[model samples]
Target: MTDHAQEQEMEIEALEAILMDDFKEIDPSESGVSTTNRCFQITLSPQEDDLDASNYTPVQLALIFSHTEKYPDEPPLLNVKSIRGIKTDDLNMLQEKLEGEAYESLGMSMIYTLATSAKEWLHEKYGQNVLDEVVEEPASTKDDIIIPHGEPVTTETFLAWRERFEAELALERAKLMPESALTAPKDKRLTGRQWFESGRAAAKGPTTVPEDSEEEEEIDFDDDFEDDDDEMLEHYLAQKSEKSAEESKN
Candidate 1:
């Protein structure tokens, strides 16, 4: 595949994976598309087995935003069709962003926004039920059950932990990020150097140990006779000093 095609495929696949595993609550399949709990609904048209937004009706196009470019910050672009009644302000904003030579060259990001806007526009023009499909999950059975308490953490638990960690890391990252960078448009995200600096600052923060705390750590000496001998010598010297003082008094 060409670079454009490859990038599109990767984006689609990545979106599918995120929707299926993370957004299972959305039930993308209810709209006649095949999907797991992850919101990415796979569809087949004529000879093809997957969705191609270029082929979808204006309404069907809007639903694509549900899973594929689900985030408000990172939207997908659809090139095939345009919404009929987009607000003037929205249009102007989009035009301004598109006019940038930089955005024009970043075809993937541009396409993403197009696809995402198309999805939302479809829902607005059509109705919600237009995108709803029957969502069916497999019936649960005891066969897959290893008792939770007795078992090591399940895949779900590990995934949950990872998600929590990611969220915490994100909060820490945000804390370290320049306020200007944080408020900038999504496309104008922090550069690699900024990210590295923020990450280093984040990594260094909560993990720091205070000097007093370090000093308070009990010294762990070796369990050898040398320590015992040192203690004995100190006691002997103290006693000898006392006896010598008595002799001096005599």
Candidate 2:
């Protein structure tokens, strides 16, 4: 057989494997078509587990199609028919949709795709019959509909979230600084180089900066110098003491 026929056979086998009793091979002549083409029928409906038999208007459809000589390269002919309670209008609409899909799916196996689309459509349209049931359904029916959950946190996501959260948190904390958390007055010492760089040593006398004064700030790889801050403080104090001793000696 040609690739087209071989592909059709494989698709038929896959459908049978999946649908079991719900799929069947039909004689092309039965649908008033020539025997040269192959035909198939698949029954479709909302999942039985989702239906409320008591209040449900049962619906089932038969999606019938035949592979053409150039099928997959060209679209196949299809017919949708009511097998149970499905209406003529519904069948027509579904067939229209399948035809559109078949056009889009040219050069690929698509009967199974169409069948799946039909089943989902059927469920959307007819599956809601369960809502009409007078009795409350068991939780199992509710469980049938998966509640989509959040995506798992990946390393990339975690890092992105942490960056955003820390920025927001810092902004909020900056807006409120408790007085109890303020450094004690005695503990207000600058890094020694920072004091000299600030030009505070040029001041001749006591300059009391108002605690309430708004000081506009003008905004370093001195890493090794961090360990020498205490030594720098002692050096400055010793020079002041020596100057005082020389004055005393004079």
Candidate 3:
């Protein structure tokens, strides 16, 4: 294969790794697909205290990636295949923002950038404060107004929303507590400190030492001892006792 072809393959691999690592909302299968004709769906949900939590529902978007035969030399195409629970205006805004990103990031890895831009747009447009104040009036057409236009609230939706809200609340509470108090495990898994220390050590570099070598280092301590100071102390004490006895007799 040519150098350009090799570079394109590397770019695709980089994109795949990024999606797998950073975009946890994308499924494993979806992230593993070939980048030649990449298409996948991703879901974005707001944090519990997001301004529009009252009308918040998860937004799903289908992403399509197109790359030229000379990929890294040319910018990839990112188009939204489908979007649910987002208004047409918001969808258009997201597309515009993505197009701007693609143009700005020409000759660079743009797939991850495009996906992150879309996520930001979703949060800005859908995760805003829509129910800030009570407006008094219009009792007749109150039912006609939809806070979030597309999706209706059902049992399943409510349960999903409640679960997300509670999880976010727990996370916030955890943040407020002292680090020592946040030691309880939510599941049978590594503790937070263990995870952090492992990650830190990994970042620092390799830290493997042979068991026998470590034991040898631990046992190599000095064993010699001296008692000159003790002898000196005893002589000083005997002299002091003689002086005190002579003083008492006088």
Best by lDDT: 2
Each candidate's lDDT (Cα)? 0.44, 0.71, 0.55
Runs of candidate 1 exceeding 4 Å displacement: 1-9, 19-59, 62-111, 128-250
- The TM-scores of all predictions, comma-separated, are 0.19, 0.48, 0.37
- Clash pairs detected, candidate 3: 52-128
Question: How many collisions per candidate?
Answer: 22, 0, 1
lDDT of 1: 0.44
Candidate 2 or 1, higher TM-score: 2
Across residues 1-250, which tens digit of lDDT does each residue of candidate 3 receive? 3466667667667765755532323433454334545334444443333434325445555555656666655666555534456666666677777777788887766676777777666657655543333355756564443556777666788999999997876564444344554665667444433443444345458746787684433321122114423333444466568889999999
- Per-residue CA lDDT of candidate 1, range 223-250, in tens? 4224543443444456568889999999
The 10-residue segment of model 1 with minimum total lDDT is: 40-49
User: Which 10-residue window in model 2 sums to the lowest lDDT?
Assistant: 173-182
Better of 2 and 3 by TM-score: 2
Prediction 2 TM-score vs. true: 0.48
Itemize residue pairs with steric clashes in candidate 2. none
Instruction: Kindly provide the TM-score of model 3 when superposed on the true structure, using C-alpha atoms.
Output: 0.37
